[model samples]
Target chain A: MGRTSDAREKILGAAHSLIELRGYSALGVAEICRTAGVPKGSFYYFFESKEALALAVIDDQWATQRSDWTRVLKSDAQPLQRLRQLFEETEAEQLAGQQNCGTVSGCLFGNLTLEMSNQTEAVRTRLQEIFDAQVDMVDTVITEALARGEVTVSDTRAAARSVVAQLEGQVLFAKLYNNASQLGALWTNCLALLGADSPHVPTAA
Target chain B: MGRTSDAREKILGAAHSLIELRGYSALGVAEICRTAGVPKGSFYYFFESKEALALAVIDDQWATQRSDWTRVLKSDAQPLQRLRQLFEETEAEQLAGQQNCGTVSGCLFGNLTLEMSNQTEAVRTRLQEIFDAQVDMVDTVITEALARGEVTVSDTRAAARSVVAQLEGQVLFAKLYNNASQLGALWTNCLALLGADSPHVPTAA
Candidate 1:
């Protein structure tokens, strides 16, 4: 049982990095098995198919990201400051990815969503749930900001969508431009969207 | 000469539809040749390789999209109104795609950027060029808006990036949710980003 679980994790980790770097359609089961150093039969034993493995990858990546989000968002910082910290951490993460891979990999969810959303219903719906959850988290933060007079906005939901969408777009630009500095504007534009009066300097990790 | 040009155009047209619907990695040369009704030899005769054909697709699709952008942006409409028209037109296009394929295909450039940016230099640089052109066009419109007092922004270039980024993100969401209506807020958020005073209804086509 221990080895079985270990093999499953190895396979998932391999798929995650491959998909992160090269995208969904380009990588196949054979490469994934070879990368994980697991037998092909073991892969089928763990996952019904490649699509199933991808769904698990999405679920696992989201769980990992959600933990980080919950930590930053639940901190005692002010709502606007919390938002800034979130983006700053994102920048740091992208820089780390660049250090490892020579270019920023952007968001796994955003990358997978764009590549597979139209091609597969299961992946698309799963990604929608992830994004919806993200919006909910952001909406909660925005509502708190409104209560504390940290920001002003007529519609919190639309504002949340804008914040999330802007971040995704910035990451996409970062990937396209191969420049992590392009992501610097995410926090400022986010503050402007939320009607924050004063800009906060990005906190270094 | 005429027959050679026709074969090249036919191959490009087939690739355009396939890549737009499926993506770059999933579609292969043989399928494209079959779809174009051209011989394998003919495909290579016109283009150097699959990557070259994809480059042509990017160039061709951008040419198609830029024409629409120019028509809307260069009209007699006010700057803010023109921007709204652009997003409205984008929404209509996504809806049309959804009607055809039961899913929003999003921006072809964006989709390709996420999938192939890390894998291939030619495609990544081509997409970056396309995005730069788009930002330039938006910057010009924003400059006009600034001159006319229709909008106020400190940095028009950053503002243009924000506009372009927000639209890309919204289309991504539309694709993720498989609901074109998710893109409805693009114009409103864009107006807010530009510091425009009020929302402009999308102009009739």
Candidate 2:
């Protein structure tokens, strides 16, 4: 049982890294097993299919990200300040990723959304839920800001979606340019998207 | 000679559609040729490699999209109005895409950026140039709006990048939800990004 779980963890770790580096379509089961240093049989023992493995990767990555997001977004910082920190940490994470891998791998979920969402129903439904939850989290922050009268937007839900969309969009640029600094705009842009008044501009920094 | 060029066009057409449908990595020369109704020999004759074919498709797609953007952006319409028109056209185009295909395919450049940018330097540089040009065009419009006292943004270039970023972000959602209506918030969002007054809100509709 110990060795069996080790093989499963190995496969998951390898698959996650490969997926981040090369995307979903370009990867093959043989290649994944080779990268994991596991036998093909072990792969089958762990994942019934590549798609199932991808679902596992999505779940695994989101599990960690959701925890980080919850901690930062649900922190005691002011609502806007929390949003600002999210972008700061996002930029830092992408920067760290570039330094480690020599290229910004971009958001794994965003990459999968573009590459596999159209082709697979399971991936699509899962990505949709993940993004929905992300927006829901941001919505909670924006609602807090709204109640405090820190923002001007009346539709907090749409505002949250727009904020997440901007992050996804700028992250696309960061990936395209291989420059994590491209994401620095997210905080300022987020402020604009939420229609916050100039009084909060200095606090944003 | 005529037959050779015909085969090239067929391959390009098929590859474009297939790339739009299933993405680049999932496709192979054999499948592209089969879909194009061309002999594999013809593919070799016209293109040196799959990468070359992809470049051709990128150029072809950009040429058409660039023309459309130039026409709308450089037109005689008021600057803000042109931006509004651009978003409207984008929404219509996405909706039309959904009608034609069962799913929304999102932006080709965006899809490619997230999927291939980290893996291929060639694709990365090409997509960068494309997005740079896109931001440049939007910058011109935003600058015009600024001069007319129509928008309040102090940094037209950053604002332009933000606008395009918002478009890409919203389009990602559109594709994820497979619902074009998700793009409807673009005009309002764009206005907010520009710090425009409430005056343009009526015109945005």
- Please give each candidate's TM-score: 0.94, 0.97
lDDT by residue (tens digit), candidate 2, B1-205: 9888899999999999999999999999999999999999899898999988988999999999999999999999999899999999999999999999989989999999998888878888898999999999999999999899978776888899989999999999999999999899999889888878764353112
Residue B14 in model 2: shift from native, Å? 0.5
Per-residue alpha-carbon lDDT of candidate 2 for residues A1-205, written as tens digits (9 for 90 to 100): 9999998999999999999999999999999989989998999988989999999999999999999999999999999999989999999999999999999899999999999999999999999999999999999999999899888786888899999999999998888888999898898788877878664452112
lDDT of 1 at A147: 93
**Per-prediction DockQ, in order?**
0.45, 0.58
Candidate 2 yields a Cα-based lDDT of 0.91
Least accurate 10 contiguous residues by lDDT in model 2 chain A: A196-205
List residue ranges in candidate 1 displaced over 4 A.
A199-205, B199-205
Name the best candidate (by DockQ).
2
Question: Candidate 1's residue-wise lDDT over B1-205, tens digit each?
Answer: 9998998999999998888788899998999999999898998899988999999999999999999999988899988788989999999999999999777888999999999999999899899999998999898999999898877677888889988998899888888887888778887677667766563432000
Clashes of each: 0, 0
Indicate the residue-level lDDT of B22 in model 1: 86
* RMSD value for candidate 2: 1.9
